[model samples]
Target: MKKGLIRTMLSAVLGLACAFAFAGEVQVAVAANFTAPVQAIAADFEKDTGNKVVASYGATGQFYAQIKNGAPFEVFLAADDTTPAKLETEGMTVPGSRFTYATGALALWSAKDGYVDANGDVLKKNGFTHLAIANPKAAPYGLAATQALDKLGLTQAVSSKIVEGQNISQAQQFVATGNAELGFVALSQIYRNGKITSGSAWIVPASLHEPIKQDAVILQKGKDNPVAKQFTDYLKGPKAAAVIKSFGYQL
Candidate 1:
């Protein structure tokens, strides 16, 4: 009777151990501008699959530095394609795992009504006293904003009133809290909860800037993790695509 009871306990322990080993979580390094859509998509992904996602959001430049210094991120959702491509070439990311996840749009926004023109003509008139923009060297959205200024011939004229943010999120906050009269920000922020918010915004035309093709890739640290692949596949599906689009991102 004693031997039989010991066998039963051992079997139960082994069974629990196996279950724990099979349950996996994938760690994702996300860009700041993608915060809302990615969070929504991650929730849907967790529902569809048992796997869980742990995401960290920051500037692409910061993520790039961390990845290069051997950060343990399983996947990188970059604000632009360049960093992921570089990582793949450097053998830090899994080959053939890179793809464009979303296309971001740059917008001039103000929390107040009528601060932005429907056609974006306010840019030419220098209508606002202060305009916030991200750091062009670090954030893709900032680069796009700079490009828009150049395209509209407003770069030199508007340089003085420009206040710089380290990332797109900060740029949005500057405008949202009235720190700056208006600012360049990600279009995603304007469309929260599946609806456009109170702020008036003008989506910068694609013709005025280079396409912000956001990309993602599985990193070397998570190359063999089943959860990483599962999460990546989930982001490409219809449900996740719908969530991404609702945030003003183009899939």
Candidate 2:
């Protein structure tokens, strides 16, 4: 029985070796907010499939522009599905390759303790002089923040109090450096190392705004790439899902 078990294990190892021998490299363009989780997933995927994954993280709009201009990206993981679906419609993405992987949540956070209330009623208090948000025209987090404010009836009232950043990372930097007292940031930014650290935050309820459903797709550039297809499949697997959930994002 022990000999049979050893033979089975060796056969499995050989099968894995053969799989790796046929795998190549994949280049991915991922959204900034999903960076941490995607990096973790990439490592696991490479180990499992013996394929190297090169990933770049940036705003969805920026990536969309890049892809339209013929960026050499094999896969796209967007913060919003609109861009991916648009790519599909434009014949830039492989039809049927698009899938929703996660939903993003917005949070109001401050680097200073007690600067933000748990319920986020502080926004109505007018105690803060500046509130940071990403550029609503370009970033999904910014759009969500704008929607939240509108839902709370604070959009017009707080317009003068707002500081706009180019992207979610910039908005986070604005709050971190005290350029803004409180900022709307992606939940992944504040909740790092397996927990929330910096300051208080109120996770905006999903009902308060439009759903930020993140989508992933194989780009036209990688249409025939074996490595890209393998990575895309690995991303849809359980290990990647766990890594995504660990980053304080809903998968």
RMSD to truth, every model = 4.7, 3.3
Report RMSD for candidate 2: 3.3
**Candidate 2 per-residue C-alpha lDDT over 1-251 given as tens digits, one digit per residue, 9 for 90 to 100:** 99999999999999988987787898999888887778788888878778898998888898899999989998999989898999999999888999998988899999998878879999998788899998888788899999999999999889999998877888899999999999999998888656777878888888888999999999989999988888888888898888877777787
Candidate 1 clashes between residue pairs 3 or more apart in a chain or in different chains = none
The candidate scoring highest on lDDT is 1
Q: Estimate each model's TM-score.
A: 0.89, 0.89
lDDT of each prediction vs. the true structure? 0.88, 0.88
Worst 10 residues of 2 by lDDT: 191-200
Model 1 residue 199 distance off true place after TM-score fit, in angstroms: 1.2
> What would you estimate as the lDDT of candidate 2?
0.88
Candidate 1 residue-wise lDDT, 53-158, digit = tens: 8999888988899888889999999999998998898999888999998998888888988879888888788867899998888888999999999998899999
